[model samples]
Target: MSKIVVIDPGHGGKDPGACANGLKEKDIVLKISKYAKDYLEDGYEGVKVYLTRSTDVFLELSERAKFANNKKADLFVSNHINAGGGTGFESYVYTTINGGTTEKMRSAVHNEVMTVYKGFRDRGKKKANLAVVRETAMEAMLLEHLFIDTKKDADFLKLDDNLKAIAKAEANGIAKALGLKPKTVKKEAPKKEAPKKDIPKKDGKLSKVQVGAFADPKNAEKLAAELKKKGYKPFITKE
Candidate 1:
């Protein structure tokens, strides 16, 4: 069975959410959401993913929820960056939703994202009657990646590695929860070539001079720097 996921990047365009510490929630979440979508499309099989808003355009909360409901999506993930004091990763499900797959998804995504942002506190799976979770017909959850207000969190978000890691984890969690499989990659066999005739060996004694040998490349670099100062062009090679 094919699984469908709708990724909603919260806030956009004119509505730049929580602009603090030189980071914008809307922009950061959009990058993460897009990354997740790309990962699912490229790596996961039997899965179809869609984004509510691909561009930096404002979208109504109702519209986002309705899009998933109308599409009959299997899962809905809303991405956002938090602000206003607290610092950490948090995932939320609809408060009215009892213990079920949706709740399990919340836990899965929370844990996966936390693995990458381990520095931040794990806020744990929470419950709230948010529009995206409350109105969507399918399993839905909202992810607050990190606090944009907190300087530490904001700095972390600034790193491209963290964003990519968070996106990958989110996709992986969703794929696992939905029982989706990864796309099969075929490996090509090594090509065989016929044996070649041996060539005549050169009869000459080559003379070479060694400058220095060091296990650490930094030491070799330091020697090279000294050589350059002495008006010599030094080249370093790895053995």
Candidate 2:
């Protein structure tokens, strides 16, 4: 049976989460979770991963925990960005349960991710009664990637490359803990060449990836706020 990992991106939609220095926790966590999911799917085998919420959608805390429990996930990892008076990477596991595969998994992920965040302070691994971790049946952990309130941390997270790097580290760590192997990508056989035909030249243009278009300006503004947190200068075009 494949090992099941459920990733929960903390806060979304109605919940803006912790906001500071023009950064929102909801946006950062979502981006990290999405990138992690993609990396694991494309590079690893014998693992099935699921997200509590895929997009900007509000989910109750209980609902998030229930989703993982219902799925019988082998592990639950919740992603979040911190706020208020701290700047660094910190991870949490259940307070009572210590020293086992769970702690090893937490350490594996924390070490891998913190290595990339070398300049940032190492807050160290901790234990807490966080809803998702406490409620989930499987071994669970929650990660505070960095502090949104801290200028240095927020600036680092604002870069797209940093987000991708963090995601890769976490995903790779999870794969390592699960003893996963890279999937074998099949190579296609080369085909015989055909005679060339005349083709017309086309004008070059820049392309943009859009998240959504909303009828209400409030909704549009919300998306723009989230995008801004991701270091995007998004503007809504009226039609």
lDDT of each: 0.89, 0.90
Candidate 2 local Cα displacement, residue 53, angstroms: 0.4
Name model 2 segments beyond 4 Å from true: 185-239
Instruction: Quote the positional error of residue 76 for candidate 1 in Å.
Output: 0.2
**87-149: candidate 1 lDDT, tens digit per residue:** 998999999878888888877777877889876798888899899999999999999988998
Candidate 1 to native Cα RMSD, angstroms:
12.6
> What would the TM-scores of all predictions be?
0.77, 0.77
RMSD of each: 12.6, 20.8
User: Which parts of model 1 are misplaced by more than 4 Å?
Assistant: 188-239
Best by lDDT: 2
- Please give the clash total of every predicted structure, in order: 0, 0
- Per-residue lDDT for 43 in model 2? 90
Candidate 2 residue-wise lDDT, 45-108, digit = tens: 9888999999999999999999999999988999999988798999999889769999999988
